[model samples]
Target: MNNSKVFGSTLIIAGTTIGAGMLALPLASAGIGFTTSLIIMITLWALMAYTALLMIEVHQHADNSATLHTLAKQFLGKKGKWLASFAMMFLFYALCAAYIAGGGAQFAERIANFTGVEISGTNATLLFTLLVAGIVIIGTATVDKVNRVLFTIKVLMMAVVLTFLAPNVTESYLMSMPIEQGLVIAAIPVIFTSFGFHGSIPAIVNYLDGHTPSLRKAIVIGSAIPLIIYVFWQLVTLGVVNQATLIENQGLSALISTLATTVHQSNLGQTIGIFADLALLTSFLGVSLGLFEFLGDTMKQRGVSSSRLAVGLVTFLPPMGFALFYPQGFITALGYAAIALVVLAIFLPIMMVRKARAQSQLSHYQVAGGNLALAVTSGVGVLIVGAQLLITAGFLPALG
Candidate 1:
């Protein structure tokens, strides 16, 4: 049991899960209210943790160096691999678009404040993506070292912002009831995506050399860190800001301004601005690294010989195009990511494990509860996708 390896893996999971999604949580959950949001987050954490363990179970039967692309190809055949590929593209692209839309606007605003230069949204997205894309193309080590620094700053600012905001919370606000039952359904997509670190599970397994004990400890502790931070963040954000204000401040910039007014701490806005800017960059780097790896792997598997810049283009372009057209898609993009994640994170693992059980030699490690538990997990995935469809069709109301 190498403690350092497990600890590093834990931070990867925590860092990946705790980024831009934090920016959207208070607004998305506002319609459903704090208590309901808290319950949903806990339930989803259990589901995500369980699925991550299922991935470990699958890893037991496969080579640890196997990425998701290799595993899907070996276990489920071409159609299955293609499905995994599609879902990964959808999820990663949506997330990149989200970070760009959210972060680019922040960048543009900050620039205008400091230098009186107003960058347009598309230019901002392009510039912001260019800045981070190089670090990603340089590869994982650079991204990891940079993300560690950003993640640490985010944690410290998160603590300070929570401290300032905590004293102003009204108990009644914390207990506010859902404005509409349907909004609870809508909030599921965003909240579900918030727990996404399944993208980095293979990386974790490889880091620990497929040591089951270390993998289990890393996944549990890594994921739990984000859940704890989210609890405190939700406590402060939802408790201090009323439902009407949450509704009014639909955009992140507006929300920060609202907090400044509501909390009356002059520095509160500055703290939140720094925290959010760091959050967006760290999350972008994390998700982009995942995309970079996934895309690079796919290209190699297909014998597509390409340079790092080529891979970077494929990884960053579609999202930049999306952000270009619909510049304020932060929340909407997350919803889309959640839908694709239902397939990538939840359904794919269920299929792999079931197939592994059938064809491979029985491994010592298996997720508790047999086929019934797998079925239940798949069922929950269905519900999340369905909820998103309802929102898309205007059958359910989602907060901005």
Candidate 2:
């Protein structure tokens, strides 16, 4: 129960949760109104929190530290293992692509603003990838230290943006917009993606040496930090930028560009640009680290060489290729990634917990609400999946 360990683990969870997905929040919820968006945010936060706790419970039941792949195989057999691995890989790859595309755009914009020289998105992606890949290749210990610093800078930048925009945010902006029904459903996936901390649960469990109370506290506190940050962010962005403007602009870059023009402040725009790049960078480190470690471990278990370079290639190349080809699909990538996340984070946890219960193997830390909670959580997961499918099929209109 070392306090520092708890704090470090908490930072890991918070850092992972607050990433590129956040850049899509204001746009996604724009049509839904700020008040309804707030309610939706709180609801998704509680749902994700519960699912994350379930993941920890499953992890603690293991004799030693095991990943989602291992847990799925042990509890749900080969089919489960295959599905879990595919979902995890797809989700991570999609997220990596989204971050790469986002980081490159933000980085390129910052460069152009400062120097008046334009860099192509593909070139920016390659440059940013190579830079962060070096730090990621060094290993998780280095990543943890870097993440701490980056996380602090990210929070401060967010504060600065909010502070500048605070005066412009009126009660009218917060309360005036009408909630659009279909748009709210569309925003749920984005909200889920924003609060996505479950992927880091196993890493945190190992980090804290399986101390349940400390791990639980870290999850709760870490998740709550983003919840607070998001609320204020929505307030500022929705307050300053109108709903129609968000819908028209329709992506992270456009949103920020609009903010700058609307606010008539160059410094504010620069601060937010820097903030976007830092946010994506920190998340890239956490996610790439997770993917690298998972692949390296799986390779070792299969009696293969898990060298740094080998794992780095496997971890980054596909996402890099995708980002290169589809450099403008940041928010779309996150939305699709949410489908895979629901499978891995939400649906998988409920199934795992139920199987563990059936086997009479319980952990010291169990998520309460029992079968009813599982039913509700699973239903919510299914509904999210449905929304994603309908959106993908063009049955429901896509939100920003």
Candidate 3:
């Protein structure tokens, strides 16, 4: 394998994994405390890594050009294709809505802070949506180049946050237990969503020219980058901001505003806002590109015109409408996304691997652990879905 491709693919996986999700992480895991959250993070990282290899395992037996749609159709038939379609649509739209809600508010906040001229939340959302839509319509390479710059800025901002908070950040908060145990269960879905670079597996495999060992190395190291960064994030944010503050302010906007003043560095909050904007923008570019392509494919299948501009319009409509009415759409949409991801990311990969293995006539690359591994991973996915359902229905305690 060319070493350069491996490095590029590694960045792709890492960039895709680290996104606006970090803005939501502290709030989600705040009540559960850092230690438990760390355990959960590591365990889920392994599970996500395992499923990604399972994805590659399926690819080895299938066509190199196959997408999730083709893979599902080939392995699990038409019904499975339909199911994957619905789940992908749901998960992508939810994420688009989320970035709009969170990223737009931050944009508006930044504008008002600097210029003293307030932008309406809806207008801000519209502007950001159009920005992403335009870039995605241009092409993938544009998005890739743009994301690299934003990711670089995001890293710098994160470094600044750590520096500002370092003097006061304590490890004690990492040791703090949940005020109520149920928060641990409640935190699972959000945390699960954080490790979501699985969607990039097929693309990365293709990018690295189907070299399995290189692909495996890319997956492990790429996923691990976000894990280490998240650990630092949890340490700084949780160390200073107690559980009560996270509970009191459910709105991301409100919570971030509090952080600005809480940390006593006058510019720290603004720095964090810039960090979040880049995160949201990078994530939006990725998710929008995926949805745009998926929707374009659907339109072509149904004999509709799949022009770039026309498809882009249809892509943003649903999620934009949701953001208009649901100002709190960021957290709400992410919660809904967690459930859809359980189907799209976890269960589908497991089912495809099972079917592919059973039908293979010759030896090929396998991900190890056989049937037992799939069963265990699927079980965890099920638990995450159940936990999310409980949180949605108000049966479980939710910190934010």
Candidate 4:
């Protein structure tokens, strides 16, 4: 395999994994304590990596051009296709809504800082939605280039924030109050959302032309980059800002504002805001592109036109409507997206892989640990689903 292919694919996976979800980490994990949150982050990273490999395993058995929807239909019948389609649509839509809500708020803040004029959240969200949707309508090749540029800027900005905040981290803040068991359980969905990269698995497989070793290497390395970043981020944020402050205020905006005050650096707020806006924009572009392509393909499969206008309308309208109605729901939207992710990325992959094995299908790349691995993956899925259910049923409090 060529070195460029491996490196490019790795970037794709990394770009897809690190996005709006990272912005919520400090706030979402704050209640759980930094140390415990780190452990959860590591566990979810490993679990997500396993599921991503399983996705690749299933993809290998299908045609190279096949998507998750197509694979589900082939292996799991119409019911499976419906499940995959709904999960993908729901997950991507939630993410798009979150990006709009978060990104628009940041844009408004930045503008207000400069002009001394406040932009309403609804107006900001509409503007950002139109801008991002326009970019998505241009198609993937253009979005791919823009994603690379944005991803590079995002990493650099993250490093800058980490560097500035490193000295301000207090030991007292790092080891803040212990969390209730229920709160920790409630954080599972947010943590799972942070490690999401399964959307890029099929893209990587096609990018590498099904080169298993290269694809495996790309997935492992790409996923690990975000894991390391999350650990350092949690340490910095939790070590600088108090738990009570995070829980009381909630969301990335509050975190950034608090960090600025805590560090006594007013400019830090603007820096972090810019960093966050870029993060959301990059993630939104990647996810929106994936959704657009998927919808376009499905439309074509059904003998629809799948024109740029039609694809763009289907892709951006629902998310825009959701964002318009619920402008301050970045973290809440992420939790919902995580639930859909569990269904499509976790449960569906396990079911498909088992069916593949039962049919005596073989792949050059199989997730090791056999039935035990499958069982463990299923258990992880159940844990996530149960956590969400408990939150919905009022047995556990929801994360902000």
Best by lDDT: 1
With a 3 Å backbone cut-off (N, CA, C), the pairs that clash in candidate 4 are none
Name the lDDT of candidate 4: 0.85
lDDT per residue as tens, model 2, 89-135: 88888888889988877878877888999998888889889878888
How much lDDT does candidate 1 score?
Answer: 0.88
Which is the better candidate, 1 or 2, if ranked by lDDT? Answer: 1
Name the 10 consecutive residues with the lowest summed lDDT in model 4. 357-366
Quote the lDDT for 144 in model 4.
Answer: 78
| Residues 1-400, model 4: lDDT tens digits | 9999999998778767877898898877878888888888999999998888888888778877777877899889999999989999889888988888778778788779899999898887888888888888987788878877887887888888999999988888777655688988889998899998887677678878988888889989999998988888888889988888888878667777888888877578778888888989988987888788878887998998657888998988888888778777788788888889999889999999888878864535678989999998899898988888888799988776
| TM-score for candidate 3, residues paired by index | 0.95
Where model 1 places Cα greater than 4 Å from the true spot, the runs are 138-141, 360-363
The local distance difference test score of each candidate is: 0.88, 0.84, 0.85, 0.85
lDDT of candidate 2 at residue 392, scale 0 to 100: 87
TM-scores for every candidate against the unseen true structure: 0.95, 0.92, 0.95, 0.94
Give stretches of model 3 more than 4 Å off: 138-142
Better of 3 and 4 by TM-score: 3
Give the range of the ten consecutive residues with the poorest summed lDDT in model 2: 172-181
